[model samples]
Each structure stands twice: as structure tokens, then as C-alpha cells.
Target: MTQVPFGDMKAHYQQFKSDIDTAVSRVLASGHYILGPELDKFEKDFAKFVGVNYAVGCSCGTEAIYLALAAMGVGPGDEVITVAHTAVPTINAISMTGATPVFADIDPVTYVMDVNSAESKITEKTKAFVPVHLYGQMVNMEPLMKLSLKHRIPVMEDIAQATGSLFKGAMAGTIGEYGAFSFYPSKNLGAFGDGGMVVTNSKENYELLLKLRNMGQSQRYHHDIVGINSRLDEIQAAILGAQLPYVNQWNTRRREIAKRYNEGLKGLVTTPQEASYGAHVYHLYVIQTENRDEMQKYLSDKGIQCLIHYPIPGHLQKAYTFLGYKKGDLPVTEHAANHILSLPMYPELTNEQVDHVIAAIRDYCKEKNTASVATPMSAQVAGR
Candidate 1:
């Protein structure tokens, strides 16, 4: 059995070893590690890339969301609407702000927030709408933006998985009032460790975010309102700056890999879909099937690594029991949780490995179909 690894981080590291090393060394020599020049440069560069006027660096993506909410005065008795099928961090950040997370069902095909469901759920209490760009594809943003305008509510984009993605030529994060991003080693533009940023066009919100991240101090120790320590350190920033130049190239390769997967695994399983209005970075090439558990086991036994992006929807989790959601409440999200599977996806994946994965899946499906069909038909013929 040949071992095919899932995500090749080592291969990614080796691709830019010299530049990463130099970036790290430069940061080390500066002796200003936390919230230093490196962070400044990275924030500026990232802001430019995302097509936003300002970007504020923070500890992690969750903190970025929290800070954005706090900056916008989203607190107790507020309801933030988002999809049930997303990283828990999205809900956790809302919870951190002492706000309630109201979940809307995902679009059955795109696995993003269903705008109609979201609009129906909104009420006078809806302080914000967090449209997560899940799986490297933006949600249906044009209608969502119109809804936002109609309600006079703020929109914060949870763009952790979609750094380079676009919706109607506008970057994912920049479409809303605030865009939160993550660099958690596996994202399209990952850092060496935990890092995040919040982007916005409003100068007022930008200044507020800076203060909120630094213990509410406009200057040294002149504390204002209460805040937390959520600064993005210099090492991570330096590493991110080193990798930022190649992010577009990496994203292009990921799209190519996704195209191959779509072609190779077409009829046997329900592959991912790319909506006409946006581009997907293929953070994880997820496929759905009724026989998901068996397929996952077969791939594992065959020395191929695969994983479930999420096995449980946020509404159904034990932690959200107080939200009063039952199993059948979110039908689409619940169904997807049981059936979706993420295959090996990274820019470093080679064509040979992709072909191997495709062949293995086809072989498994062929045997299963053959056995099920032959036995039943043979028995029918005998009865006849």
C-alpha cells in the first residue's frame, strides 16, 4: 500500500524556505516582536490586496471577528445572523461579544448562507449579519448586500477560508463593512502560526479596532474603554508578508486542482459547484455521497487520507442546545453534515496523486455498484 498524504505542509515550506527563513531572521534581529513594523507592513499589504482602505492585525481569526463586532458596538441583546454550516469560531466570536448567534440554513448547493432564510430570520434585534465565505467561495452577496441596506444593519464577512476569492470582481472580504480573515497554516494564505486581520473602508471603524485590540489605549497606558490583548505578533506577520507575494499563484494552482477533481469524480459522487458570480480557491474539494462513511473507510484502508470538513452542524451541536434547534430544523445543513467528505487538497498536490485518488474512488464505486446490481438482478431472474 502506497501512502498518499493529505495536506503537504512540508512541501509548501520547502517551496519558499529561503524567503521564509530570511523573514524570520529579520524579525528576530529587530527585537520588536509584538505589534511591530512587520505587522504594519503585512497589514498595509493585505489591506491593498483585499481592496480595503484599512486592515487591522490581531491574534487570530476568532479575535478578529470579536474585535470587529466590539468596534461596531455589537454587544448584549444583539442577534448576529450566520449559516449553521461553518467553523465554530464564527459563532464563538459572536458569543464572545455577549451576542446571540441566529443561524440560517445553508444553500443546498453552495453550502453558504441562504439569503432568503437569513432575511426571514432578521428582526429588530438583528445587529449584524456575518456572511461566511465557506470553502473558498463567496456567498450570494449581491442580494445579501441589498438586504443589509434595507435593514440598516452591518455586514461582517467571515472570510477565513477564502482569502483570494471574489464575488462579481470584488474581493470577498471587501464586499461588507468588515471582513475578517485567518492565516491558520492551512488557509490559502497561511502564516507560520495563528494570525488574523480585519479589513474595512471606514476610517472610524479602523481607528476603533486599533484601540480595541490594544487594551483600549490610544497611547501608552492611557487606557480608555475595556479591551483585550489581541495583537498579531511580528514573527507571524513577517512570515505572512514573505508568503503574500505568492498567494495568487498558489490560489491559481488550487483552482486547477479543483478543476481536475471535478472532472475526475463527476458522476460517481456529487462534486463541488462553482457559482457563476464568483471564483473558488478550493480550500477543500468536498464531495457528497450517500455512502460517505463506507467511502471514507475504504480510502483510509487503501492508504489515502481523507477527512470530513464538518460532521455536525453548529445548530445541532450540544453547545448550542440553548438555541432550541432540533435535528430537522436545518434540513440542508443537517443532511450535508452526514454526507460531505473532503479529499486531499493543497497547491502542493501533484497530478499523479490526484489521478491515484480518482482511480481508487472509481474502483471502490465500481465494485459496490457491481455487487449490489448483480445480486439483486440474479435473484429476480431466478424468481422469474
Candidate 2:
């Protein structure tokens, strides 16, 4: 019986135990826990990696987006356009700014915001577009940027899932007005605890973010504007800094694992696809199947852990009922919610473990006679 976990953070930590421990010790000795040198260095390093002029660190990804929206002046009576199939935080961040969250359906194949659908939903009230880079694959930013310039709407990228993903040679988060990232332990660039970053090229926006994260203070105890206390702590920043150097190598391994999964599970499941315009970092090797529930149960029984990235689209959730979205409003998003399953995915996932997981899924598919039904979308599947 093979036991493969969905994500092994412990394994990840163990791989870098020495460096991480040293970083943590250094931070502990500094005695400046809140917004110290660690945070500053990590922000600079992350900004350099993403090719942004400034990167602002915050408590978590949700706040990162909220800060971006708030700083960009998204407020009451405004509407923020985003895909329905994303972490609730994406919508919550918009709503927290007292703006209406406008939902758009995702592209069935990419499971990202459908640009056309998003464009149609834009109105006079639409203030910003938040294209979630879900599952480590970038949304098509080329058209999204054009739409942003045309409609005069600022684009805030929810890059919680994509850290190193590229779009036409540019990094995923750098193309938008603001890019928000999460370092939740399961992410590709997981920190020891909750962390997030917002990046931007505009000096004006960057300065606004710095003020917003620290209660609108340009100087200590000098409140410039009403803001929230959401600074990224020094400990988490140090941990992130330690992990930062290895992100590219980890992303490469994740892609290799995804390729193997695609080849092994070709006809058994609808695997993730990399867009022609960008690279996928394989944050979670999600697959879609008609028998998602049974498949998950089968894998669980075989000691292969599997989970759903999202079982329900955000619009259909009880929290967003006021948004006026119903079940059939977004067919593609609804369909994906019912069928997507995230398999064991991480940089540390071994070939043997990946093979075992694939073998278990194939066994279940054979027993259930679930031949692949991914047509039109099959060409989009990575390594197909």
C-alpha cells in the first residue's frame, strides 16, 4: 500500500532544514519581529524576481489584494470583475473594499477567467479586474491588459497560486496594475506561516501600499490615512527569504511531475493544460472527471490523498448570495466545480509516488469504465 499525501510541507521543510533553521535563528536574535530587515530584504528579492519596482509585504494574500484594491481607489459603488471559480479570498478582498464583486465564467479548458465573459460584465461601475492565476497557470494577460487600457480599469492579479508563471516572457503578476501573492504553506513558495506580497511598477501605487500596510503612517506614529495593521512579520519574512532561492528549481520539478502525470493519466482523466501564452508552475496538478467523488474516494482508499481545489464556485456559495448569481449563470465554472480534483502535487513528490497515484487512478477508471471525455479541451492539456 503506497501512501502519498496531497502536499507534504514537512518534507519540503526537511529538504531545506539547515538553511531555514539558520534563517529563523537569525530573525529570533534580531529581536525586531515586526517589519524589520527580513521583510525588507524579502520584498526586494521578490520584487527583483518578478521584475517589479516594489513589492509590499502583508499579513496574508487576502489583505494583499484588499490593499491593492483599496490603494487603487476601489470603493463603495464600484464593481470588481473576477472569475467565479477561485479562492473566496479573491472575492472577499474586493467586497472588503465595499465594492461589488462581479462574477465571470472561466474558460472550460484553462479554468481561468474567460476574457470575453469578463468584458461583457464590465459596466460603468466596473473599477477593476482581478484575474486569478489559479492553479499556477496564468490567465491570458495580453487581452486582459488591452481591456484594462481600453476600459480604464486597473487589473489586480490574484497570484496566490502562480509564483514563477510567465505570460509572453513577462512574469505573471508584473503585467497588471497590482499583483497579490499568498505564501500559505501549500503554495509553490510556501512560508512557515501565513504571508503575502503585493507588487507594482508605479511609484505612486507602491508608496500608497507601503502606507496602507502600516496604518497609513509615512513615519512612526504619524497617521496619514485610515488603514489596517497588516504588516508581514519578520519571522515569516525570513522563512520566505530562505525559501525564495529555490523556487525556480522547485517549479521545474513540479512541471516534470505534471508531465509524468499527464502521460500516465492521458486517457483516464482530463489533466491540467499550459496555455500557449505562458508557462504553468503546476502548483496543484488538478484533473477533471465526471466521477470526481468516486475517484477521490478510490484514491483515498488506496492511500493516495486527493482533494478538490474548490467544490463550489464562489458565486454559488451562501456568502455571495447577495451578488445575485445562481447555479446556471456560469455553466463552465459550475461544471468545473462539480468535477475538478487535485491530486498529490508538490516539488518533493517522488517519481514512485506519482506513478503509484497514477496507477491507482487508472485502476479506478478501468473499474468504473470512465474513458476520457475531454474533447475540445484535450488539445489544451499539457504534454498531451
Candidate 3:
């Protein structure tokens, strides 16, 4: 049996080789590699895809979040609440804005930010609610919206992980004040290198973000306000545009894989659960299991790759010790940090590979059970 790789960017690239080559050729022929016609078209098309009025591409997903927050005037003396269970980039974005990232716990099931924890973290200085649509599942945004409205704070979505995902009938990015997305090569619709975008309904905020991405300048050599040079490259824009059409198709396959795992590992594994309003893109088919390490090693031995979405909770990271969070601060987030495992999930993953992963997990659990049985005899002998 051929080894199943963790992420196969090479396969997707080969599949779209002609399109990618053409995209690159067009950019090279145009002689305009920065923000140009192709970038504009991609931004507009992506905005339409997300049911938003505008989408501004940037250097990467991390920059996308920081630019959106900065455009919203989130800075020192302000607080942005988000999940502690996400990638470090989300927390880093908040810190970049000079704002304190007030963390919230996760819903034990969805593994996204808990809205109740967000509510409790709100303070007078809270300026925005940045909910992470972690692992392509939307945070229960209805209650999050209510909390935002009550506190009069904006919700900037860190949709870095969810590309084709939907929150309710509306698309993921459109539900919040600003939705930030990533186009890293591994994402559903990724770019050659790092790239990102911000989507929104408000033309005013959209304009601000555009200016911020380009050194706060509306036009070349005409600087209006303080900004950063974080524009998306024209070449990446062309590449992403070609892949956009296939995003939904890939997401569907991911969902099918998720369903297969849910049924196949019903008794042994705890698979992801979808909220009624959520249309999951399944960016990472993460499972909650107590034997995460053992399962990981078991799968590794079978030549199946597995990874942890996050091994360390954000609060425990040395960078944020000053936040005054201890090991047990947020029980749910901390506990989950130890148990989460990301199985190989992608559109191209085959049925045989999926079965191999499942079989390895079941076999590992059975062996452990048998081991504990033998341990009792050793214990009794020691006592005598």
C-alpha cells in the first residue's frame, strides 16, 4: 500500500498545472506583479463568492487579521476576545494591534469559541469580538452577534481556516463585521505562497482596509494615513482566481470524508459535530480522543500521518505568560489542548487510506485494553 501523506499540495498543483502555468504566464506578460488588474478581479470575485461587498487581499492570513483589526481602530486600551484554542497567528494578530487578546473557552463539541465565555470576558475596553472559525466550523455566531450588539462591539471573524464554509444560510465571512481568510497552499483555495483577504459589507471599513494594506495610501505617492505595505501579489491573485471555482467541490469531498469517519469510528473515536447553521468546509477533520498520543504513534507506524491542531494552549505559551493565565485557567481549552488530533483530511484523500487510519486507531485501543488486563496479574504478584 502506498503511504498516505499528510498534505498533498503537489497533487492539487499537478491537477491544476495548466491553469497555474497560464496564470503565471499572464502575470509575467503583463509586467505588473503588484496590485493590478488581476488582483482587483480576484478580490471582487472572492467578495461575491463570500456574499460580501468587498474583499481585499493581503500578504498572508496573519496580516489579514491585523489589518482588519487595525482598520477597525482596535489598539492599546482596547480588548479583542477570541478562542485560545486556535493557531498562534490569531492571538498574534490581536497583540500586533497593541490590544490585549482576552481569551474565551471552546464549546466542547464544536471546538470553536464559546460565546458564553466571550460574554464574561467583555470589559469597557472591549472593542471587537474576533471569533475564530477554527477547523472550518463556525462559532455559534447568532449568540455572538447578540453579545456584540449588546456590548456594541464589532465581530471580526478569523476565518483563516474556513474558505467555503457557511454560517447559517449566509456565507462565513459575511456574518461578521469583517471576515479574514487565508490562501496558504494547504487551505481549500490556496495561493502559491502566503496570501490572505478580508471581506466585509461596509464599504467604509473596506476602503480603510484597502488603504491600510498599501501603506494607508488610496493612490500611489499619495499617502493619507499611517499604513503598511501588505498588498497581495498579482501573480498569487491570478493563481487563486483559477482555483476559486473548485473550492466548493473540494469542500464537499471533505464533508463526505468527515461523514465517513463519523460512521466508521462511531464507537472508538469522537468525531467533529456540525451545528445546525454551520456548513462546514472540514479544513481539518480533528477528533477529540483521550489517547491522542498513542493513536498518533499507532497511525505513524502504519505510514499514516496525523498531527495535533494545537499542542499548547495559547495561555501556556511563553509569549503570553504576562496575560496572568495559569495551567488550569480555562479548563475546557486546556483539557482539549491535550486530546485533539488532526487526521489526514483533504479532497484527494482516498477511501483505502481513510480505512487504514481507522483500523490503526481501533487496533491500538484493543491492544491497550489487553495490556491493562495483564497488568492486574503483575499487581497481584507484587502485593504477595
Tens digit per residue, CA lDDT, model 3, 180-265: 99898998888999999999899899889989999989888899989999989999999999989999999999999998888778
TM-score each candidate: 0.95, 0.97, 0.95
Model 2, position 142: C-alpha lDDT score: 87
Model 1 segments more than 4 A misplaced: 370-384
Q: Scored by CA lDDT, what does every candidate get?
A: 0.89, 0.90, 0.87
Candidate 1 achieves a global lDDT of: 0.89
Error of 2 at 67 (Å): 0.3
Span of 10 residues, lowest total lDDT, candidate 2: 375-384
Candidate 1, after superposition: displacement of residue 129 in Å?
Answer: 0.3
Runs of candidate 3 exceeding 4 Å displacement: 370-384
Model 2 residue pairs with clashes: none
Best by TM-score: 2
Q: Candidate 2 vs. truth: CA RMSD?
A: 2.5
Candidate with more favorable, higher TM-score: 2 or 3 = 2
Candidate 1 lDDT over residue span 296-340, tens digit each: 899998888999878988898899899898998877777788888
Task: Please identify which of the two predictions, 2 or 3, would achieve the higher lDDT against the true structure.
Answer: 2
Model 2, stretches more than 4 Å misplaced? Answer: 372-384
